[model samples]
Structures are given as structure tokens and as C-alpha cells.
Target: MQDPIDAVLIGAGQRGANDYGPYALRYPDRLRFVAVAEPIQERRTRFAHLHKIPLEEQYESWEDLLSTPQKARGALICTQDQMHVGPSVTALQRGYDVLLEKPIATTPEDCVQVIDTAAETGRQLHIGHVLRFTRHFQKLHQVLRSGILGEVINVDHRENVSFWHMVHSYVRGAWANQADSSPMILAKCCHDFDLLLWILDRKCKHLSSIGQLVHFRPENAPSGAPARCLDGCPISDTCPYFAPFVYLDLLPLWRDVADTSTGLVKFAAKTQLRAPGLVRAVSKVVPFLRQMSDYRGWPRSVLALEPTSDAILEALQNGPYGRCVYFCGNDVVDHQVVLMQFEGGMSVSLTMHGHSHLEGRSTRIEGTRASLNAFVGFRGSWIELNEHRSDRSFRYDTTGEVRGAHGGGDVELMTAFVKSLQDGSSQHSLTIARQALQSHLLAFAAEEARLGKRVVDMEEYSERYLS
Candidate 1:
């Protein structure tokens, strides 16, 4: 039997601790975390304890962890957007292959630097473009490749960033500002771009984009609303984006539940039947219920290490997570669209909006022979293929049995990463730095086009930034 790969984790935040970290625990035979570096003491300690790493191997910063060459086979760099490049480059130079959390870097130059450093050090650098590893997308790619659709002509894709998710991760969370992180497109929709590129297997020739922060400004706040949700906002009950509704109520309820159609219906009924007074009473009796419905995972986990009801309440009351979405001073766009002309005559459009009722992705592909319609959501995933000549259609659905986060792409991505390392084959790597660069470049170009209000030629953009 092959031995498991020993890896170090940098920045034990959401992705590190909750997403990728759990892979080690699930399949210790495939991967093991030997060390962790996180500035936050709570996160660092928690990750160390979960992974069973020794005290000597735990470090408060990436610098300290990589100060001397360690014995780990690789490093998982899951730091914040702006902090990705340095640790990634350092890890490569320190003789550790890296699986870096996405956006590679906030800027094109930094992204290229990580790619270049990896090449120079002869180390593997995999970007976390988990969408490509998903079964739904893989099936989509397979159908497209099968030529059942004939010559592809155009494509339309929509990234429906659920309203609550937009307010949580973008408006009030870590990626609220473009200057602090990457643009909303890069931070959130890079996966979309990567998926499109991978499935089509064509380079985008030129593109134009337009978007802006239409809502979530101070002007949109209710007249009597306070700065924070816990501060007695007047519209707390009616406001869909209310902080408590998300952290205290919805996220917890959906923590273990799949957020499927039936799950959402049940959630709606529960919320509607129970009055605010009843909810408060229940929470008082079961304090932890206030923070998370009954589980201790993401959204709430992002708030506190312990994530007890008291800690969650404290975070909501005092931390940024608790702030009013409209008054949070976030500047990223609420909606955006990108139009791209691929190398061939095929054209594609990608629309990303934060006002979606459900968090999912939907796409339509048109071809000479037929067309394909697909949707992948937390509820489930489905695909329909229509043939023009035969006048027939086929549908595939996985309605029940909830897929894990990111449509079960997270675990598949980790499995691929481990397999690549085990076999020591770059050809088997799904999201190598160079291949992932295409999406990042496209995202950067899309942002530039949006800001400059003009079309960007891919050749010129790539030469100017990447060359």
C-alpha cells in the first residue's frame, strides 16, 4: 500500500479548517496534516488538535513554519486573498509542493509570480478550482465532448450567488472590498471562468464587462435601522438580509440539512410558524441554538472557534459578521456580466448576481445539432439534452441525497490533489498553476473591461500582464 502524503496547512480559516482540513481526517491513508500555521491562536490550536500535529510543528505564521525546511511533502496555502502569493512562493522555494486556495493572488503579476516560482523550483502548484473536479461539471464536459451537441456556437452561464451568501461572504465578510481582496469576479466567479474554459477547451479572444455596486450602500438602509442587526434594527423581521436571520437562524437550520427543495420548504414553514418571541424563548432555553440551529460548522464556525451560542451571539453583536449589510461599507459589485468571444466564432456570456433566491449555477449551451440545459444547486443537480434532428430530449436528475459543499467538488479536488502527489505526475493534475492562469487572466481582463468600459483583447492583456 502507498503511504499517505504529509502536508502542512497555512491559514486555518474557512477553507483550511472546514473544507480541505477535514479531507485529512476522512482519508488519513491518502493525506495527513503534519503542521499548521495560522495567526489566530484559536484557529491554529484547533487545527493542530484536529490534525494531531505536535506543538513543535505548530507556528503562528507561515514565515515561522517555513523558516526551516520541514519534512512535510506539501503545503496547503489557504490564507486570505491578498496573503496567498507570498506563502505559496515561499513554500515552493522551500521545497514544498503547494495546493493554493484560489485567486492565486489579488493581481495578475502576483499570480504570474507564483506560477514562475513553481516552475523555477520544479514544484507542483495546484489552484483550488474545485468546480472542474465536480461530477456535474465533469458530466457536462463529457456531453459537450461527445459531439451530441454538434459544433458549439454560444453559451450562457449564470452564477447565482444567493442573497444571504452575498451578504455573508462578500458584503460583510472577508471579500467585501476589491482593494482588500481581488474583485468580486476573481474572488467569487473565478471558478465559473475556469469551468467555462475547461469545458470549452478554447481560449477567450476578447471580452467586455459591466457591473457596479447598485445596492448595499448606506442609502439603502432602512430609515430607522441601526448599524448592527443586534442593535434592534426596525426592519429586522422583514429584512431578508438581517444578520440574525442568516447566522442565528438559517445557517444553523441548514447546517446539517441539505438546503434541498424539501429542506427549504421545511425551513420556510418553521420560520413562518414560529414567532420571534418563540424563537427567543427556545434559544434562551437552549443557548447554543441561538448561534447555530444544532450544528457547529461554517458561517457560524467562521465566526468563532468554539461557536457556542454565547460565542456566536458575541460575534454577531461585536464582530463584522453582525453588521448591517447595507451599512457595512462594502464596495464590490452586486451584479456583473461578462461577454467573451472565444478563439472560434463561439461566443459566451457569464452573468453573476447576488440577488438569487437559491445558491447555485445554471448554464445553457447551444450547438448546431442540439442544445443542453443544466443546473447545479444545493438542492440538487440536473441536466437536459435536446436533439434538434430527432426532436427528443433526455433529463438527468439527482434530487435527493444532498451533495456536499460545492456540489461535492471539495472532496474530489482533494482526492485529485493527493492522487497527483502520489503518482508524481503533473499530467494528472487538474488545476495546475499554468492551466488555472487562463481563468485568472480572464477574470482580471473582465474586471479591467468593466472598470474601463471597453473590450479587452486577450492577446494584448496576456502579453502586458503575464509576459
Candidate 2:
């Protein structure tokens, strides 16, 4: 367009693709999809072809893309949880500014390292805290900054993750295991931490909380259940969560393809249904997932860890939450709440309840002067605020229009990453890893609190966790 090119998107996932938006097509003169690095071959290849990038530009891994290109300026790293660090740090070292996804790292150390690397390299590393960038939170931030609500003293937010989503991401999904992926807090609530910090404009000084797998365990599993929810399972009839909404009920929604005319000619209109992981890529690339959403009872395959005698793990795999002893290996928590005190004089109290609502939703912010609320329902949601003003009150809620991953964050986050590159900025400008690390650290502390039934010290919390 203007020069050789502007930047490259890394994941080609929900966030990466949506960020491409009109910028790639409408302003072809201003931007281009120089290359893409997605793990999914079908996705990466299709993305490359769609963007018109030659086979040479399409990369299987971020490593190959940055290493070969040599002159790249911006990068969007959108892999899964455990994979955040290496690519981000390496990208910075390679001189490509980064736009990383959130929960920076499952641990604090990774977050710190990513942040420190960026500072040392002088490259941008914008974390995908897309909510802050959206009209919903942005308007709320505007209201808070506008002083209509007065100085924010405290905030309480509860992100209500749906029961089905809980099973997918936390119980049986890729992020079900904390050690392998991220603690429930970090995986789910990093945004809450960032947001509380953002709205308060303060640093978290002391933080503590608790959480556990209250539901979706063997204890919660039906009285007479089988290991799997498939055919021949002892009880698929009465079990509510037998066929998972994400995997089965919504299979048509998430996997259904339309026939414009009927044959291959019409397939282009709804090809996502044809491909294996195309929906997941579209989940990564397109804006609709954020804007749209779910069905019910999608089957989740369960895996039981035998070595541990935690009793908790045992029940999670073979008890009520597990459907029947022939379990649907659900090994994650259904609820968690964390308490945070900021060095900047801001305090936050937050919770994430997966089985609480139909859709993953959130709402909170209670302060001495004013309070705030934000929520997303199966149908839709809104963000609201009311100040303790003497004369009148202030308000705002812009939730519906925004669409895509984690409440439309993936798209907005990707957009930020791409624009930062076009603007020649660094990741430090968006969501930094250090703060992400701190948030994650708080997550572990919360888990400890949940288990031990006590408050945790912030300083003491650090020695135990690192991204």
C-alpha cells in the first residue's frame, strides 16, 4: 500500500482475523496482511489464500514468520494460554513489536518477563485487554474519568461465565487444567484485575480471595451415571448436561454451514461448517462470535488423573459432576472470587461463577462515592454507572454492538495490536505482561484462600507463583 507493508497478524484466530477488518479490504492502500502464523494448518492456509499472501509468507509458527521476514515491525500473538510467553518474548527480541493476548501468562513471572523484555527491547507489547478498548467499558471509563462519578474508590465485578462455557473452557476444554493452562482466576479474571486497576488508576498493593470447583464434579454428577455421556451411558436421559451445548446442541450453530444454492458454488457463503477447525479460526478471526453466541449440552470427554488422592480430583472425575462414574472428565472449578487492594489506593472484589448464568456474564463496582455495573446475558447485556452526586446521577451501557471472543474482546484487542503497529507503538501501551502477572498471582492466592479458608498476603503470594 504505502510502503512494502505495515504489519502481520500472528494467531489468525478470532482476534487476529477480526482485527484485519475493513483495514485490510477497505484501506488496502493503508494496510495489508503481510503474513500469518497460525498453528492450525487448514486455518493458516485459508487465511493466507484469503489475504492473497503467497505461500512463502504463510507460516506454521510465529518463530518461522519473524525469523525469516527479518524486517517485520508489528506482530499479533494469539495462541492459547500456556503458549503466550515464548512467542511474545521471542518476537520482542526479534524486533517485531507485539500485541499479546491476555492473562498475559498463566503465572506472574512470565508476565514480568514479557513486560521486561518489551521495556528492554523498546517494542510495544499490547496485551489483549480488549474490553478497555470497547465502547462498553470505554464509555464507562470515560464516565469515570469525566469525574461524573467522582474519584473511584472501589469496584466489585463478577464475570458470570455460563454453565456450558464452564464445561468447555474450564472443565473439559483446552483450559480445564490449571497447571497446563492457567489458574481459573488468571484464565478467566485477568480482565477483572486489569479493569479494576484501570478504573481505579491505582496499583494493587495487597490482594487475596478464594475459589473452588463447587459444581461440575462427581459429587454433582447424577446418582446413576456412566463414564461418558455418549451412547450406552447408563443415564443420558435425565442428566441435564449430557450433550454439551457447545459440542452438540450448538453443533449446528457453531458448525452448521448454509447452502446458498446447494453445491460447491454456494459453499463459500458458509464454508466454516465444512472445515474441521474453521469455526475455531473464525472464533479467532471473525467479529461475529463476540457479537453472537451459544446453545446447550455439547458432550465433553473427561480425563481422570489417578495418581492424585486429592479426593477432590477423584470426585471431579467420577462423582456427580462427572455425570456417572463413567465420567465426563471435568476437572476445573465452577466458581471463584478474589479480593484486591491497589498500591494506588484502589481496591477490588471480584468473582467468576461459571454455572451461575446461561451466558458468561459480569457486573460490579461499588464505591464510597459511586458504583458501576456490567453484564452480558444469553440474549445480550449492558454496563451502567450511578454516581453519589448531590444533584444528579450519571450513567452508561454499550454492550450489544461489540462482538467476538470473550465478550468481543478478541476483535477489539486485535484491532489495538494492529493499529499500534501502524502507529509504530509498543506492547507496553496496551495491556502489559507485568500487570498480567500480578493478576495471575492474585489468582493463585485466591485459590489458596479458597482452599485454606483464610486471607492471603500479597508479598507472600508472589514467592509461590510466576507466569
- Candidate lDDT values, in order: 0.84, 0.61
User: lDDT tens digits, residues 146-186, model 2?
Assistant: 66555566776778775656665676566777667877777
Best by lDDT: 1
lDDT (10s digit) by residue, model 1, range 298-384: 777888887777888899999999998888999999999999999888999999999988788999999999999999886468889
Q: Which consecutive 10 residues in model 1 have the weakest lDDT in total?
A: 251-260
The best candidate by TM-score is 1
User: Model 1 compared with the native: what TM-score?
Assistant: 0.92
How high is each candidate's TM-score? 0.92, 0.74
Cα RMSD to the true fold for all candidates: 3.6, 9.4
The true-versus-predicted C-alpha distance at residue 52 of model 2, in Å, is 2.1
